[model samples]
Target: MAWVKWDQILLPYDYGGLNVSSLKLKNYSLLTKWWWRFLTNDNALWVRVIKSIYGQSGGLGCNSPLPATKMKIFSGRNWSQIINIDQTPSKLGCNLSNVFVKDVGSGLDTSFWNDIWIGDLPLKDAYSRLFRLEVFKDATISDRITITFDSPVFSWAWESQPTWRTEDELASLTNIIKLHKFSNNSKASWTWKHNSNGAFTTDSLMQVLTSLTAAKLPPSSATDLSPFVPKKVGIFIWRAKKNRLPVRVKLDRKGLDLHSTRCPVCDDDIETLHHSLISCKFASNIWDKVRRWWKFNQLHLTNLSDIASCSNPKLVTTLGVSIWQAVVWVTSYYLWIHRNNCTFGKNIDSAAKIFSDIQGKCFEWINCRWRKGALDWLSWITNPCRFDSIFTKNGIG
Candidate 1:
């Protein structure tokens, strides 16, 4: 749930979600860049300074020429954590190495087996049996590949003779290395695999971390939320569908000892996400008026999915679908906002007033963003579904 909040926050506002990032994820994402820099930017002065103290901090660490008498990393050294991201327990599921990969050039700065220089997973992970039998875990790519005139030579280190399953893993690993192209011309570097330019961005890393965690949750069906609606409205719809909305019933179910989980507005039913957003006496009346305004049939919605999918495809063309979706989403967002007002003792507008506000905001945003789809205020309020031309799905006129 927290990850989802951060995801929405990081989304561009016009994409119909919130702004800002979860500070923890943001910090971790930023820290990963230091690891990237240390792995690739060997000549940079800051990287050099760290190498002078940390004394070759193992595979994929700075490979600068030794300054002599360097000590192992000790406490109070801030970069130690970033250098060991692969071994760290990440709050965002997998660690930094999962999103980043090694781009071997001279291969001096990349781990031959531990770093993800060759395949999707590190050789240590993909060939764990062979990795277990290996003596040197910190062998760099340059240590394994050597250049002799025009051709390259490859070598390996083994603790003991291989046999059986270990032999099989060694066979597969050998086959992979045989196909790897090595050159001594370019410097080895690390790259963020997710981006086109092979560079790091906070947003790109956050997206990967979010995706890895999202898979553990139940799948959501709220895809294709309309671009016509406000970001808050899109985020609200997404959360509601995923059952992550902070309605009283859900909070109480999660062991929040509320005074009552009853509907915050009407106090007629437990304020489950569905009831709070759709079936509450207040929300139901608002929905009825909104349906009437859009010339939609008043179907009795029993679930959040029903309300979210209320716009009829058979009745509306492309242009009308966008407008209708915006109206429905705006209506839902205000209903939730009004519910919060009631719960917090804020000024709760009447159902009519809330509905009016929803209409006004929808018209303002839709017309402003969709120049080709602009509507007269009278016709927009009267019925937004009456479209005969300029029917593009993106809401552009």
Candidate 2:
């Protein structure tokens, strides 16, 4: 059974999720890139074929919508759906067109009023009053600009005389257009605003989509996790933080017919994620060993919230705190594994053996992933913090 909302699970790590990629969002990004290709690469054979079939006024998603006849005849195709891709039908409710930008050059290709080539929005949106008075809505940049006397001139074919409000909008729009410098030598180009170099990339687009759709969770539930341990361990901790770890009580709550809700390890209390990993008798013994190994004061960790504070920054340097975090999480991983073994009636390692095993595991991981190269088995087991002897010299030892 699903414990968290699918939308919440789709968020990136910083937003209380595993950063699982959304296939719908990914497919949308890919289709949007294809739309970019169709508009920018006018010489491609497929683009030429599409332009011929869809009518050249606007290719698919460029300016004007497809003609009413074609809209109904081929409306079932993916291309038709892509052209009208707006925020309303989107998975994350993000407007894909917001990332689409138009760069004007010779202006033969770009639509003057329909495309977002200038200002914060499309000219049709920014100057809607003036747009209502235009006779040709799909006119290109070249259609509106006339070069005479070595200077560019503006021309507009209005439906009729404009109201006072429409005249003011026309003047404002004209002044904004004058400030934009256009080149007569180059062709108009389309750009993905989410990326550099005006190119489209799935990775860049996914990040943009994540930012738009990701919901902010409470700070207590979300945290910036460390990369010291493997992802599986991190995922376990994340699930534990959310209290979704399939413990006996949680399973019973989910309508599973378990024999009992008591923790199988000690059979002392109801098994919740916190009780299974933090305050249980067997788990508490492992935590105490880890606490002393890290040289923290004798502070009891009755709550899972106390685990993070166990690695006191004042007791160890920043580097030492990172190493300590790895030890804490690795211990948590093995403790859960031992609990499973006990539940299944398998032989279990003693507490000392578990501690020794984690020491070796942490030593191998830290020595390889960390670049200091100052750690040895002897130093790690005794005091892993005394890195390069400089850490001890600083009196953090």
Candidate 3:
């Protein structure tokens, strides 16, 4: 659950999730610029500094001649070089194994066997048996090419004769390579694996990290609340869904010295995430009022997670279900705010007032996204069901 909270915090702003940056992923993103600088901007001061430190040729003020080829510069430094200047390396930094190259053009600078130039994998990886039998495993693109005055011809040099299995793999490799024709004028470049264009963007990097850790966390079944709800409400609902908001019961379970874990509103039982958000006396009253308005008396909402995942497939259209889910999220959010105001702000807002807050907020927020019909407080209260009328099976008008 703690991990889920962390993931929630790390999610991007557009997703209605918290904005927490992972330094490890950020460092990895920044390091991608290293390849970018090496290929594109050799005159960059940082590139020159790096080249000088690693004892590579070609820099701004260097008397030494440029390396025979770009491959020499690539071969000079290991991708996982550890350079500690004034500060030590952070344990948070992402591993080098996660990084790979994407060939943009000639594939000249990339290692033929090692780099991920073909598809989302390397030729060596796709044909491991052929890779093992290769005589020149570390050979670069320039080494294998036959340069004529007219145009460069491509060829491969392997060590051993192919068996039946190896022949099939070689044929497959030949077919794949035949699809990508190299140009003499084009230079091969490296790109981050996280993005489609092979460029490094923060959003893409965060998404990559989020996806990598997604399997360990419980999947969120919540509907798309970002289009209708406020960001604060969305975040509150997200926290509620994850069961990560700091309720007194959780504090007590953590061995914290608490006088009591009773709900501030009801004072009947432990102030658990479920009770405070759904089943508490105050929360239940609020939900009852909302249910009466929405006419969902049959719907059973036992916890915030239930509200988060309110989808009725039996309905003729998704608009009603989506609107109802948003209402549930909004109601639960205000109930929480009311509880906090009572406990921490030392002011008890009535259930009527809290429900009113929900109504006002939902109307204001949803109006921003809902465009099918004119929405006023009168129409909202009297014709709550009609909110779904503004939308259809396709989507909102």
Error of 1 at 272 (Å): 3.8
Give the per-residue lDDT of model 3 (tens digit) for 1-397. Answer: 3525565456455443466666765675565455445645556886677666544323211112244475365544644232221022123333333354445465455567765556655567779999998888877766655446545566766777988999999888766766655655577555566668777665665565555544445554433455677767776777677677878888788878887789877898889889898889888888888877776645677656578777544344466666666788888877777778766857787889888888888888877777664465675787677644443433333
State the lDDT of candidate 2 residue by residue for 58-135, as single tens digits. 344334556677679877877677676544325564555556666788788777888777875778889988888889
TM-score top scorer: 2
TM-score of 3: 0.62
Q: Which residue pairs overlap in candidate 1's backbone?
A: 16-231, 17-231, 372-397, 373-397
Report the CA-based lDDT of candidate 1 relative to the real structure. Answer: 0.69
Residue-by-residue lDDT tens digits, candidate 1, 1-397: 3526445544433343444455766676787767776766778888777766665433333232233333252433566566555443255566555566665887776677766777767788898877877788888877877866645576778888887879888778767777776655577666677899999887787777656545544444425567777666776787776678788877777787899989889988778888888778998899888778867665546777765676575454565566667777788888889999999999978888888898889878876777554557776777666554223433333
What is the alpha-carbon lDDT of model 2 when measured against the actual structure?
0.72
The TM-scores, one per candidate, come to 0.65, 0.77, 0.62
Once fitted onto the true fold, the runs of candidate 1 whose alpha carbons sit more than 4 angstroms away are 1-22, 43-49, 57-73, 84-179, 184-207, 216-218, 221-229, 244-248, 251-271, 280-283, 297-300, 334-361, 388-397
RMSD of each: 6.3, 4.5, 8.2
Clash pairs, model 2 backbone: none
